[model samples]
Target: MGLYDRYLALRVRTTDAAVPEHVALVITERDLLEQGAYDTLRDFFAWAFEYGATDVTVYVSVLDRAAAPTLARELEDLDAPREVAVRQPDDVERADAPITVGIGLGGRSEFTAAIRDLATAVDDGDLDPDDVDETAIEDRLVFPNDPDLVIKTGAERLSDFMIWQSVYSELYFTDVNWRDFRERDYLRAIREYQDRNRRFGE
Candidate 1:
């Protein structure tokens, strides 16, 4: 067996958990930028598309200095059909395929900052109560969407991954680092997710 297969075998044998039918992965731009692996992100997203991902949303926080527009532009330039999209807050367009790629403005920040920004805008008269019809300051910040499961591999801390969307998402953490993340490790995480009862605030 290949090394990855071996790891999968071990996990499956040891972990008596079930596998989830649908799965979504959230990767931080820090990891991608640090490794200079924009291609890796592209490949992973393409794979996810082929893997029957009903919906795929990739958020590029303007707040991240490492993932600057230069790098994003370079990566977007190399791709074939331009499956990747560069979108601002108001430019969201619906698509045909179940899988879609979108860019948003914010990441794992407490809505505290967002609230404060909106308040500042209101107080400074940049935005009036009547002027806030369709466009509002809150529209710029990215909020986490609740996923059925969230898996964080590598590193001990939460890494400010998903603050809002993961409120009820089942979290499965592993010491396995990102570089070493193999298919088996992912399968194991899925199995772990399947085992959860997920009462979901009942």
Candidate 2:
């Protein structure tokens, strides 16, 4: 670690506030196409775990569906700190790894798929329409784990990620692009999250 990185880490460690256990990052497919993007991702995972995050979810939004396979392959091959499970938009199974990379899976499509599954269960007499609750919907979600904090780089908008799960998560938006993202950026997000008084919608 560099001197500035060490200083940032020290600040985070000394903070009395709680660190987010589950962290989510929202980036675009174009972001990964940039140079050093994969290296940044590797460092990001290490930094998150070092700071207190146990689970890290990465949502890669792709404008073209044709690019999904290529993006998934590249992300899956990334040298990360933990196991990575890369899934496409239509994937029904839940990701079981510590790090999950969703390629071209928008939050709206994920929710729609979950609803469709719930409807199927209802139609098959397996689940009553009235009995279907939040738990049922969550059970059908591909990535059901809720994150404590969500980070979005290069923009303030959440690129259609974790709609159901990130309902109560603290969001941190940075103008820095993914390739330019450094340890300091991660620490800044952590510090921002730590300083927030999370109400979880009261």
Candidate 3:
């Protein structure tokens, strides 16, 4: 780790409570299996629990069932890991483990916005609302926005993790890798979020 990273770690450790509920982790198949990286995930869950997160979801795309067994086994070993469930967009509703929805996206954007747009069109009479069911319309809509702050680390650019939900979320990116993630870094991010003046179109 660099001196700056070490500095951030120190700051996070000294910070106060700032964790929010409803945490979602977006991980590619390559990051989990190919990268042989499960420790970062374990750490994230551990920290999320420590922060008092009631609901936590792990979002995955392009999954291989063969890899699921090993990952599930590892997750089963942890105390809070059992609370974490794997999901695809189609099966998000069936998720019983603390509402951990797996949002699947076959199109260009994440499903949430598309669903909202589609529903709005139906509501606006632009499309036939009778064709879609009430539950289906509700699923596509990303209402009750729970995301307040989203931290994208290791990569300077924002990945398509919570593209729809994070439309107005405070974004903080770091070059630090997942393995090096520490409590202090998390705290600093929260502190930064606290300091921001959110202007949601006035």
Candidate 4:
């Protein structure tokens, strides 16, 4: 860690505010095309875990549906510090790992799919419509764990990302692009998170 990074880490460690246990990153599919982008991802995982985060989620929003399969294959082979579970739009299996990657899978699509499943069950007399609740919806989603902090790089826009789960998450947007992201940038996000008073949608 650099001198300033160490300082920020110390501040985070000494602050009364809680460190984010689960950190989520929102990036675009084009961001990955940049050189050294994958290295940044591996380093990002290390940084998140070093700063007291146990789980991390990377949402690689895709504009072209055709890119999903190639992106998924690359992410599955990432040299991450922990085990990773990669999920795309059509994947019904839930991705529950220390590191979960979502490629081309928008929250709206996932939510709608879950709702459609429940509707089908109700129609078949397998599940009652009145019994459906938050847990039921979450259980059907690909990645169910809600993030404590969500960081969006390059721009402030966070389209189609965790619509239901991130309702109460603290958001941090940085202008630095994915290729230029560094440890200090991540530490700054953590510092900012610790400095805030989260209301959890109060």
Highest TM-score: give the candidate number.
4
Candidate 2 runs further than 4 Å off: none
**For residue 161, what is the lDDT in candidate 3?**
60
Name the lDDT of candidate 2.
0.90
TM-score of each: 0.55, 0.96, 0.59, 0.97
lDDT of 2 at 179: 86
lDDT of 3 by residue, 103-159 (tens): 343223446545666778888998787667645544553332345666665665544
Stronger candidate by lDDT (2 vs 3): 2
Q: Kindly list the per-residue Cα lDDT of model 4 for residues 15-104, writing each as its tens digit.
A: 888999999999999999999999999999999999899999999998898999999888889889999999988886888899999998
In candidate 2, what are the lDDT values of residues 44-117, reduced to their tens digit? 99999999999999998888989998888888888899999999968868888899989888889999999999
Ranking by lDDT: 4, 2, 3, 1
TM-score of 3: 0.59
Task: Please write out the lDDT profile of model 1 over residues 30-142, one tens digit for every residue.
Answer: 55555535555555455434333434444444454544556456545746323544433343332223222333333334344555667787899887767653245336444
Per-model CA lDDT versus the true structure: 0.51, 0.90, 0.55, 0.93
- Which residue pairs in candidate 1 collide? 144-165
lDDT of 4 at 85: 96
Provide backbone clash counts, one per model. 1, 0, 3, 0
Clashes of 3: 3
| Residue 1, candidate 4: C-alpha displacement in angstroms | 2.4
